[model samples]
Target chain A: MTKRSYMAVPFVLGALLLILTGYWGYTQNESRKNLQTNLGNRYQMAFLDLSTHVEKLQVLLAKGLVSSSPEQDLVIFSDIRNEATSAQGDLGQLPLANPALTRTNQYLSQVGDFAYTLNKQRARGKAPTDEDWDKLAQLQEQAGALNQELKKMEVTVADGAFNWGEFRREANEELAVKGRKRGQINLVKLERNMEQFPVLIYDGPFSDHLERVKPRGIKGKVVSREKARNIALQFVDKGEEKWQAVYRGKVNGKIPAHRIEVKPTGAAGVFADISIQGGKIIWFLNPRTVDKENLTMEQARQKAANFLTSRGYGKMAPTYSVKQQNIAYFSFAYLQDNVLVYPDLIKVRVALDNGQILGIEAMGYLMSHAPRKIPEAKVSREQARTMIHPRLDVQAARMVIIPTETLKEIFCYEFKVMLNGQQFLIYINALTGQQEKILEVIDTPNGTLTM
Target chain B: MKKRIGIIITGLALGLLISFGVWQNQEVTAISQSLYWGSKGPNVVQLQQKLKDWGFYRGKADGVYGADTFAAVKKFQQRKGIKADGVAGPGTLKALGLWTAETRTTARKPGTSRGVSNRGDITLLARVIQGEAGAEPYIGKVAVGAVILNRTESGKFPDSLNGVIFQPLAFESVSNGLVWRHTPSADSLKAAQDAINGYDPTQGALFFWNPAKPVSRWIWSRTISTRIGKHVFGN
Candidate 1:
């Protein structure tokens, strides 16, 4: 090749090398820029999270100040403590490239120490007095200013509008001042007091449930039924009085359950159960009023009979005591075609001497009260036979009017199906063609099972 | 001319490589310093916020690693059941919700923690006593307090603190954490602190009440010794 051509080739190669160098340099620069930019973005997000937590604490403290209840106070204090701990954790995880933030964190720690001491003191029962309050207020004011300054710095970094170099220099200069404020938070008095107060109503369930339910943590322990009953009565009386504030008219049988038992008041002693519920007397088994003052066994049976008559049961009959307990039974009869359905039993246990109503079990009354209206067979006894799984073929299904309550009616197609070598009575909603409830019927070949 | 061109190419290549190496070195050093000192970067700022949420970093979340930030780091370590080292290294940063830059692509969810539970009334009582008098000077005094609680549980001490603490040599502060100038931390509170800090100054000792002023040594003699605080921690 000619010398001129060789020279031209060298020049061309040099130009190519220059282009490659420029691209590599540009890529490297861009990568570095991207890293810095990502770092900055992460910093802003972290700052925002920190400030938001502070705001949350401020809200909690404000609420606590207004409420002044031990329960509320404990909850808010616990939240504040938790938030502070979390904030500290987050800050530790970050790359605080700027030294100023490190100093700011130290200042926050001091303030946190003060707050913690305050909470502990309040928990102990001895809250900070006026002088302590004044000092705390001063500390809070300083913290507020620090928070504002941090916020401003955060905004500057976040927006990328401020001169980063200048901000860094200024932050460095302010570092020393922040450090001086660190140990200045002398909250020992508050801490010592917090260390002393025994706050019984604490952060979770015990406080939350009792407060939300508005149930008095009644201080009592009654072992006997009579005592439990007396407590129930007292609870009803007090509840009645409390209900006057905004009386939602008393609805019968709408009382909240009264769960009574003795529990620890603190470490010292257990409080007796005298808690009220729904402005009603519940769970204090007042058998005397139910058994003695109320109707006698014969009288109650008569009353129950009259009650059935008032409701329209035409052929229902009452049978007097035949058992050794002198219990009375009330029965009703219904007929479909020529078959007579055996009536449900209303067993009443009465005191033999005075004939007081000891207990009245009226279950069959619901079944007997409904009219006998069995619908025409929807899927003939043969069609329903198809829906039953082959493994559990239907043995027999009958149309029957099952009385639920005296006032309610259930025209059911009761199907007897054998499942896994066992028999089950499956009741279908004759109207909807849906299975409602099932019962496992245990009947020995010797007939041990009864309804 | 060819030799001159070759020399120039070699010189340029060497200079470029050296410059690239210097830049790389500087970038690495800057990152390491930024990370070590918890520089006011995005991750640091977020870390600050997370710490605040978890009740650790109480300082402004400005992303700067000043004294307050370091103290907050220490506090976080204390809370996280880690060594209370102030430096925010990889472990501490990960804990604080910051990932090592190298760990960026790994995709981690931040700031979830598990805690310990102290169960039962008797165990709870032991925990509270441990928290309060764990730092007491006399082991016997701490043990005496536990003994009083034990005695209360037994048929011996009056069924209440007023009865047991008021009894002769039962407690140095018949009026402590409640009546005295300082109230001890609650049983649950102490348990929480212990679960986090592992500050088991009480050892396995159950009994503890102060004995700085006086205590019936006979009560102390009935129990085995375990050191906690200035008092004796005993069962």
Candidate 2:
């Protein structure tokens, strides 16, 4: 080739490179802008929806307070519950920090749960009591205040006082340590206003009263770190392996516990959490890989029962066994006076590879295990059987103490029945002869699950 | 110019033939390999999808042959009155209607095994753990998974695993696309399964954040539940 042609080729290649770079940069910018616009639109939509829901909630709460008839109250309460749930969902979708909206979120949850409780009461042919009316009045006032705050926010959002895209960027930046922005500050203010929400005590799951429940089974003096380590080391079945236990730290939560890490010679570590109050092993996990199935499911269950007995869990009866891979998960409940205490339960995972105890979780047992007063059934077993549908084929009958949604224990006659080739466990309240709960028992090839 | 074009066409055809030959060889090798626990590929994906369609598998149809797929294959084999071995060997494949001529060339081998009870929840939780605490200590990874579980149990958050994880802004990893972009490591998966089995090293933490990073000042208001690795957990 000629020297001039070679030089022209270099210039052409350079121009092409420049054009490619420019095009790539232009596309990247366009896509980034598109993404920002989409994100901003999502935030705007969620905020608008939240405002609308809150407005509806305010009107519904006002209607609930004025309605005297049980039928009208039920409808209004249902609407209030729905609007509150929608508002909560919308708030969750926003970019605001969770802590700043903790109180506000709690308020929304309690409002919806309280409304649901009221609806159930009205459905049962009971009108709202005076205290219920007072609580509804307080909730209505709070909803009005929240609606006002949202109205102000709606104005600021419409005026574009702060860009959501920028707010999101600022929210997620790890190094942007400075004063709060307009949008976040507004949310913080709203949360501060919610700090005065009246404490709600009711029969719902989200009631304030449930938060103060103490563990019924934690009944000993606090244990030291060394003692906790010893308890953990003794609890884990190392079996001829010299395992060293290390105190991890003290964990504080619903059950304050001492965390211990046990490492065997040249093996993966095992972690055990021992409750500090009683030095009881809350949970322990041996994360070793089980690569072969050498034991049957029955053998695994036997091993689990032996492990529990050795660990001082008395008279634990296996409720279900689910086999997956090389492990079998066995759920056992404490049996008291021939009545299964379902609330006091423990889960044992036995590796089918070598019949080894792979893990154990006793949080449920620790939370509710106590010597209970076994109430004599006022309704006989035959009476409870008659309460079940005539089509169901009664397979077995037993007494059990099941936990209600509010965590209250109820004595019931658990009837295992079959109909249309499907098995179900129907619980009839032993005291009142009323049907309490029914669970469908799904029997798969691997194991059984109750739903 | 016509002669040169003819030569180029011949060369292109020859290249195509060689590439096709290589592709054909790879396909044969892939088909001949038996799928068992820990095996991963398009074949495993197909196996899992087929099992899911037949109501034997309840796990996601990811390609990796984990415990879920192993148990599913075993269940299918039992139903088909096969040997009831978990490995998808030539015999098992033939029974599954996935057999090919290439699969007949290889002999069956015993396979490894592991298991999880709730396969669907474990997979998603494992991905979240791998994304958020993949580099953290093992306990830290479990703690992250526990936080997700605790959120589900709390009345303030969504009631189910899917609802809690998919709630916008609930998890940073979800928003950043990290959780979905990669598969969880084995340790992360185990940690997730452990958390699902109720091993909460954090006891019941609802929130966790790396203390070194800049977080919202309001986070400090929550009582500190525990600290695992670099992350400070709180209620």
Candidate 3:
């Protein structure tokens, strides 16, 4: 080939490379713009939905206050509950950081839960008390204020003066920078306004009373760090291999505990949390991989039972066992006089390969276990059986103490029934003969699970 | 000129034959591909819908084959007196009336069961744990999963697992698409199962963030519960 032709070939290749680069850049820009538009639309939709829901919540609360009829009040309260929940969900979908909207989120949750409780009361043929009306008035006022704040933001959004995409970018950039300026958007201002709502004390899960509940099961004197270490070692180390206990740190939460790391010689370490109050092992995990399944699930259950007995867990009845990855997780509830105390529940994980105790979680047990005066059943078991649907064929029945959503324990007659080849567990309140809860029992190849 | 034309025709015929052979080979392999846990496609959607119609599956037939689909497939297999492996192989597909004329049977090793009854929940949680704290210690992974669970229980966050995980900006891994990009390790799955079983090392922490990484300054306002591995947990 001629030298001139070779030089022309280089130019041609250079031109092709430029064209390819331009095409790639164009596609990248188009895709980025598409993604930004999609995200902006989502944020805008969520914000608008939140504003509408809040407005509806205020209206519903007002309607609830005016409605004296139980039937009308029930519908109004349900609407308020739904609107509040949707508003909370929409608020969660916004781009603001979680801590920025903590108060606002909490307010929405309490409002929704309070409405739910009122709905339940109205369903029970009870009229709203004067106190309930006062709480409703207070909540309605707060909802009005929240709706007003959202309206102001909505105006800016409607005027195209605020762009969630740009706000998200700027907020993320500000978060990355140290000593960043705060409150570029009015969300922080709105969150501050949310802080003035009255603290709700109700029978709901989110009630302030529930947050302050102390552990009913932990009753011993506070143990020293040395005693906690000894308790941890004794609970975790079952074999003869010497293990060293290293104090990790003290963790203060629902159950105040000292974190201890236990390691055998030349082996990887495991961590256990020992409760400071009773010096009992709250939970421990051995993270070793179990690659084989030599022991059956029945054998694993036996191993779990033996482990619990050795640890002084008396009369713990195995309720269910779920097997996963060569580890069988067995749930045991304390059995008191043939009445299963489900609130005092313990979970044990046994490796199916060697029947070794892999893990133990006793938080539920620790939170609720106590020697209690058993209550007499006012309603007979036969009476409770009559309350069940005729379609359900009763397979078994027993007395049990089940905890309500608010952690209040109630004695109930637990009946295992079958219908259309499906099994279900129905709990009837022993005193009132009211159907409390029904759980479907799903027996899969892995193990039995209750839904 | 006639001889050259004849040679060209022969070359074209040879190329057509080879292309047809390749196409046939591709069809055979495609037919042998089994739908198992973590598989996703239109075929999986069909399988799930078929299982649902047969009253064996109760989960949403959204196409992605997960633990629920696996369990349902196993149940169907058991009822049909086939091998009770949680995989949609040719025999199982044929039994479900999903097999086509081009489909072929191929033996495959059964996928190991993760053994949890709520397989879908654990799988999703495990993905989040794997993406967020895959490099952290075992306890740290479990702590991250526990934080997600605690968020579900907290009134300030969404009440359901899916709602909490998929909430906008709640998890950085979800926001950045990292959670879906990687398969969960066995250890991560175990950690998720442990968290679901109520083995919380964080003692009910609602949030966790890696101190070494750039995080929102707002998270600093939360009361720190514990530091596990590189992540600082708070409620």
Candidate 4:
């Protein structure tokens, strides 16, 4: 009878255990479903908001296309701008893959910027041209198409026939299959139906024609990437018998160049921006701190000038020197006929412990180094000296090609003076006798910065 | 319970009276001698100048301390929320920017102090102020001093007073033999003191330079925070 009771007890315990496990699992599944529903609701809201914004943007663009009054035009254009902006913001909030949305996003951003530019021009009492109106019409059509696509997707989502979970999972899996690295998970594939979505070209900031200034100083036979890498290796190569340079591709900027990163064996080296045409080293940097400083600023300055001279930079004069921690940096502008050419600037950073060249940048030299007619100062130093305040005790003076606040180059008489016993540099416009600017030579604990 | 409450009240009253005595003792510096109706000599002349500059006195330069000067002193003292006893005392003088030697918060003894380090950070501050902003307006000098102080607080820069001052490629004065050889002048020391005391005219500038220099492309890329004197302060 006791054995029979034991068997019944086991049976009862087994049933209870099975029921508990099933209940726990059901609760967990229910909570997970609840969370997913919450996520889906958020995505649906974003999608709905996105389509609504895009539809409004299309309507505003249509209004902009026909508006004749500059006052009404300004108002319509501003609305179009705000609508496009909010549409982009709504699109950004959605976790949609960007690959499908990059060009579309760009199109919206440009439309906004274009509208902004038109509004500004109208506000300035200028009339919009025929091309601008045509562009606005074209923008309205493209926005309508994008709106249609978003609306269709919204409908499918609302019907519960489409699954966002599956779409997101598939996109991630697609990225993995394609072997795309970091940040690619956020990219979703859009329906590929943009065959002739006109690459909108306008006078806005997003315009493709923004940077057309060819490299002014990069003049020589065009070299291949391999040759450019070889030049960089030779230029930075010192003491190390074997040094390899990694070729990072071209810089997609106003003046494109090949980027080469060099790391010597067991020591960090500098990056070199070599021109594709001349293969000149435009810039270099290796910020490995030299913890022990044995050399002073004078010694470091001499070492930097020597390094540049060895690298075929002819007759460079030290313009400024600053030392911080155990490193010293020197700016050396090219010298022609005992006159310092400030535009052709070359910067050198020296590790002061052993005076090793840590970095060298010559972007100014490489980009603005073409032979120029250095203009003679219209105002003589003596005449300019007379214009300064009586409290300014003149020290040294030079004729420098100083850049105006507007970034335009102008010849000026640069004068160094002591005011109230503090050193100051004053630049007077050589032609106009106008005091262009004054710089107080500020001394700090480690280095000095002119303020 | 009633006895304990009475005891507590009596103890509190005694404590408050003793503390008040201590506070009064501190406030009564002997140099703050109360002056009235009839005083004379150099101290009066100094007091008269301060009151006149602060728009309290309209009298001409005179060696004697008179009724007009006394009245002006009283008015100035009253305006500054001090005892209107017509005394050119330590507290009142300090308020008028005519602080005396015996009662000066900024009368830091001239020495190499390690406020943050043994490398003479205070001296270095003074030297840099003298070297860089020696001729700048007093406020501008303070702004220049605060820039380095701000740098020491940032994660990108060195954390110590010595590290910020002696950082390589940082100060032209350091490299160009200005800071190392500079002797801190009176104004420079005061500027450094003001800056150390948290008077930042730069509004937390990490970098400053004249807009006239061939400033690097990287420096120009920094967002400007404020402009003081000829220097553009940037963060």
Candidate with maximal TM-score: 3
Candidate order (TM-score): 3, 2, 4, 1
- Note the residue pairs that clash in candidate 2: none
Candidate 3 TM-score, C-alpha based: 0.82
lDDT of 3 at A433: 92
Best by lDDT: 3
Q: Cα deviation in Å at residue A183, candidate 3? A: 11
Better of 2 and 4 by TM-score: 2
Best by DockQ: 3
Off by over 4 Å in 2: A1-12, A158-162, A174-179, A183-185, B1-118
Where's the lowest-lDDT run of ten residues in candidate 2 chain A?
A174-183
**Tens-digit lDDT track of model 1 for B1-235:** 6667666777776777677655553331112222446467755666666678787778787868778877888887888877877877777766654554443232221110101111233233444444455443322223334344434322212333333344322333332342234434343333332221112222223345346744434335534333333544444
In candidate 4, what are the lDDT values of residues A1-451, reduced to their tens digit?
3556555655655565565557556766876788777766776676678789899998888888877997899889999888887776655545432233545666777788789889877876889999988888888998888877777666676776655555544443444223332322222223334435876777665553432334567888887889988888888735545778888666433335677777776655456667777788766555454679788888888888889889998688887665645667677888776666777777787888988886676655765677667766677778898889987799999877754322246677888999777888888888878787788775546554454
**Candidate 3 docking class:** acceptable
Candidate 1, which segments miss by more than 4 Å at Cα? A89-103, A125-128, A151-158, A163-451, B1-235
Candidate 1 lDDT by residue in tens digits, A24-79: 78878888778766755665565567766655655555554455566676676677
TM-score of each: 0.27, 0.79, 0.82, 0.45
Q: By TM-score, is 3 or 4 better?
A: 3
lDDT by residue (tens digit), candidate 2, A78-158: 998999988988887777545556678788888998999999888878888999989988989999999999898898787
**Local distance difference test, each candidate:** 0.43, 0.81, 0.83, 0.66
Lowest-scoring 10 consecutive residues by lDDT in candidate 4 chain B? Answer: B109-118
What lDDT, from 0 to 1, does candidate 2 have? 0.81
